[model samples]
Target chain A: MYIVVAYDVSEDHVRNKVAETLAAYGLQRIQRSVFAGRLPPALVKELAEKLRRVTRGANADVIIIRVDKRALDTAVRIGPALPREGNVHLH
Target chain B: MYIVVAYDVSEDHVRNKVAETLAAYGLQRIQRSVFAGRLPPALVKELAEKLRRVTRGANADVIIIRVDKRALDTAVRIGPALPREGNVHLH
Candidate 1:
C-alpha cells in the first residue's frame, strides 16, 4: 500500500516530532510536511495509531491517504525533477 | 477521481499564487501546503500545467497524486475532526 501523510501542527516541537516519527516509519518526506512511502496495510494502521498518539493534544490536523502505487507512478509531478523510481543510493 | 496536491514553495508570493490557483481549481486546502478534492483527469492535467507555468524560475516542488474516492473516504484522519463527507455549508 502507498501512504501519504500530511500534517499541519501549530506547535513547532509537535510538528518536529510528527516529522521524525514519519521518517522513522521509513516514509520519504515528499513535501515539507508531507511524507509518502510504500508500507504494508498492517503497518499503515500501526503508523496511524502512532500518529494519533503523538497528536493527542495541541492543534494538529493529520491526513493519511492510501493511493495505489501505479497511480502514484503516473502522478503529475511538477517543479524539480526527482527520480521516477524510489530513491536509492548506497554505494 | 480524488486528487491531492502538495507543494513546497520558498517564496511567499509564489506560494500564495500557487495556493490561490489551487483554490480556484476547487481543491480544499487540507493542510498548509496540501490541497485535495475530486476532479476530472483532464482537469488534473490542466491544473498541473497551470502550476508548471506559475512555478517557472522558482524553488518549488509540487506533487499531484490521484487516488480513489473510497481510499480517500477511508483515510486515517487524525487530529481536529473534519466532516467525514465533503464540507457543505450554504445556509
Candidate 2:
C-alpha cells in the first residue's frame, strides 16, 4: 500500500518527534511535512496509531492517505520531480 | 476519482495564479501548497496540462496524484479535520 502523511504541527519539539517517528517507519519526506512510501497494511495501521498518540495534545493536524499502485501510476508531475531518498541506489 | 495537486513555486504571482486556477477546478487547499478533491479523469488531465503551462517558465514543481474512492476512504486524520469547503451545506 502507498501512504501519504501530511501534518501541520505548531510545537517545534513535538513536530520533530513526529518527523523522527515517521522516518523510523521508513516513510520518505516528499515535502517538509509530507511523507510518502510503501508499507504493509499492518505497519500502516501501526504508524497511524503512533501518530495519533503523538498529536493527542499538541496543536497539530495530520492526514494519512493510502493509495494503491494503480491509482499512484496515474500521478502527473510538472517540474522538478526529485528522486525519493532511500530508494535503491546504483553504485 | 480523487486528486491531489501539490506545487512548489518560486514566483509569487505565478503561485497565486496557480492557486486560483486550482480553486477554479474545485480542488481544496489541504496545505499551503497542496490541493485535493474529486475530479473526472478528463478534467484531471486538463488540470495537469493547465498547471504545466502555468509553471512552464517558472521554478516550480507540481505533482498530481489520482486515487480511487476506495483508496481515499482509508484516509486517517489526526487533529482538527476541517469540514471540506463547498461540500454539502445545511441550510
Interface RMSD of each: 1.4, 2.2
Q: Which numbered prediction scores highest in DockQ against the true structure?
A: 1
Q: For candidate 1, lDDT tens digit of each residue in A6-56? A: 888999999999999999989888778888888999988888889889988
Every model's TM-score: 0.86, 0.78
Top lDDT hit = 1
Q: Model 2, range B1-91, lDDT digits (tens) per residue?
A: 7777777788999999899999999987876677788888899889888988888789877777776565555567677555642121111
Candidate 2, overall lDDT?
A: 0.74
> lDDT for each of the candidates?
0.80, 0.74
Segments in model 1 whose C-alpha atoms lie over 4 Å from true places: A81-91, B81-91
RMSD of each: 3.7, 4.7
Supply the global lDDT for candidate 1: 0.80
Candidate 2: segments with Cα more than 4 A from true spot: A81-91, B81-91
- In Å, candidate 1's interface RMSD is 1.4
